[model samples]
Target: MSHFESCWNPASPQALQRRAALLERIAALRALEDRAAAASARSQAVFDKRGQLLPRQRVALLLDPGRPWLPLATLAGYGQDTPELARSVPGGGMIAGIGWVSGVRCMVVASDSGIEAGAIQPMGLEKILRAQEIALQNKLPFLHLVESAGANLMRYRVEGFVHGGSLFRNLARLSAAGVPVITVQHGSGTAGGAYMPGLSDVVIMVRGRSRAFLAGPPLLQAATGEIATEEELGGAEMHTQVSGLGEHLAEDDREALALAREVVAQLGWAPPEAPPAFAEPRYPADDLLGLMSDDLRQPVDMRELMLRLVDGSELLQFKPLYGAATVCAQARIEGRPVGLISNNGPIDVAGANKATHFIQWMCQLGHPLIYLQNTTGFMVGKDSEQGGMIKHGSKMIQAVSNATVPQITLQCGASFGAGNYGMCGRGYAPRFLFSWPNARTAVMGGEQAARTMQIVAEAALARKGLAPDPVRAQAQFEQTVALFESQADAFHTSGLLLDDGVIDPRDSRAVLAQCLALCADAEARRLRPLSFGVARM
Candidate 1:
């Protein structure tokens, strides 16, 4: 490893402008996250009367103090709930992340029950399912904080109802795969929501607050003509003592969370293995804010950003001068050996071929691959076509698809076309994928997409021996541009579950370090598979 000298000038005008731009975007991102918290906080008086801890408070209590929590899909359902951005509450009404609880790294999925009484929102289902997917893939224990009003009937999508079954199925699958599924029912978990606790390997329910029944009084009475109080039906005590459902019962929210943590502590799960010796990056992580520009076309040195990520800012360049656009290197993050592939510009033929070889090499070396994506996509047009862009690009994609290594993608800027595939975008199923606030992703940029549509329309008109209607063509182009621009923004992509979550650029190093460490631990840990899942007594 060679020491990488820093060339990033933070005092430059461009850096100042980039810093200001990044701060504004980060502020906006924080505000959206704050909105979800504020929405949950609004129910505080009600929760206070009920003597309950808020969802966020419960999560805080459940995690080990001072440990990092990587919140996923914070901007989920951003524009979906309403057209007005100000009125939208992101995070799909859920708070989920990878956090440490009782020394075990687990996927903690807490229902944002403070919002809309924790009614299941459209994208909230997707958020939890994605969390389950992460736990399953990484072999992490599944911990669910259950206190939902179940699916929102008023705004229910039948598709959501049809697909929600997978959540329970995943619980069983996780348990069968030797990954424990733990649940703490802080409040109502009626209807399909009951399954979250029922399927878990460990269940801790609050005595008064927890209620996990397939149907509440109204539905129960309407369906079976049976009159019963929620307590008698599925209260914590009743379930624990009579129904053989809940294994442990607690007095309130705090006790329930404590029990959940205690349960995690007793799991005897393997801890993260010791990482290799490493030094901090040479560059200041705070400089990360100024290093990235909002404009994708503007050339930004990805090497400068990578310099701030790897240990001691040391990176051994794989192919420095050749295929310069695509940057590949061997480096250590948080003392974990990994190979990095980044782009300073669009991936051309040589860059694609270089990346292909680097990915395969990383796999052979048994190292994980980290992709710092900031490309407008593969180079196009006549010269590129003659240079075998398609074939070479395919080689990169093939390597990305079958590398047999843990690949993590960070959408730092533009991620478009086959460039996204080559860079290990969401479609390629990287071990984990995340984005920065200013990240932009689409099949192509708005202008390019609009232009392409216009050209196609004009060519079609010419084929019909007709002249293109300029006014109609211009109107269509504007709409296409607007649509693509809005949808490609990080908020939209994150809401659609395109990336794991949008993160603050300043926290990239810490986040990457944690994730890389987790990937390493997962690779080394072994699990005892069983013929059947561990069932509750």
Candidate 2:
């Protein structure tokens, strides 16, 4: 047995110093997350007065207790509404994730009604759209604990209104695809938002609180000169008893959540398949916390990561000595067959060729592929070009695009340039993609980009027969680096929904297991298709 030797020294001063810095970065991020949570918690008092549960409380009630909840895009609108990053609360005005509901995994979306009366924030619409997409793709039943003030008309943009239609369209698509959507309209779903409940497979409404109307009283009075009370127009009782828009009517938040969970259980979902015999990793999961580095330029030992991830920490490295940068290994994560591709450095001609072969091999074996991305991209310069880097790289990409298997990607560090494409970045449509908080994704490293710009500027100056000012050039380089670095950070990428979410390193194994199970179940379950989605009665 060729067991991998450990070179990591936790007791070394350099290791401690690096960890301390990384911890501070992690803590600062956690502090911002805490602030966002506290902001929502503060509004619990207001919810209590109104005989309603807070948004998170509703999610908690909806989900099966003690089941894992994998929250996504917690920083969706961070640093958007204000310049103060610390003061600006993200979460896109919603709480959304995958969790167990009625012993079945489901995609749960809840309005942060406690804050801003659940009014959608800057990027809130985009966040929900991504969440909807995940649910549709994963075939998870959708449960919505909704109470939104709809779009902020005062700060409305035409683009937001135009794109918002997809949210409804996706709901219909989810139903057509045999995925169930269960909604609980805890409050307003006015104007265009009325379609939310209208499009769902099943909808639950709170007796007096839930409202689903094309227009509110003021708009009804203005448009048709019809003076109607809130209940007369779109109240929960009217929808359930008269309008037929809502299927189930509940007295309050708790009851509404209960109905949503019950609906999930009644959706004809298949029970989980018994997994293969699993073994715990020989290494501690806590080691993952210190495994990652905030500096993207630093190299990561793929073998070490694999040791901590796979069953028994036992890995069969494929071509260990050849194509050394691109590390391919056969292993079982949770005892299910999986092939892993990770980077020790950039992808050169040999590495790309090796990966191409490995991807094909994995597909033939009917094993899912897991990509641990940490590359600066394919090798550049004269030596690489002469070695047929382009040819080999193209071959790898073709294999990745055509491979018939589930591919999951985790951005543990820099996922830059063509490396991102080859390794299944967001564009490649990996079944699932997640990122570590310390990870960064961009066309290239910030320093690399800035230096490239500097060279271009120097050449432009040479063409003009003018010498560039050293001071000005240095300033420009600094500014360029700062902008790129900030935008490439996980917080910024996650806010834009570039990846599923920014996850803590410690939770990596659990997250991957959940995803693996979901993918496996999807592959196994049979679907019944009709020409169109289930129509409203």
Report the lDDT tens digits of candidate 2 across residue range 92-164.
8889899998888888998887778788776888888988888877778888888988888988989888988
For all candidates in order, the CA lDDT equals: 0.90, 0.86
Give RMSD to native, each candidate. 1.4, 1.5
**lDDT: which candidate is best?**
1
How high is each candidate's TM-score? 0.97, 0.97
Error of 2 at 336 (Å): 1.3
Q: In candidate 1, where is summed lDDT lowest over 10 consecutive residues?
A: 528-537
Local error of candidate 1 at residue 293 (angstroms): 1.9
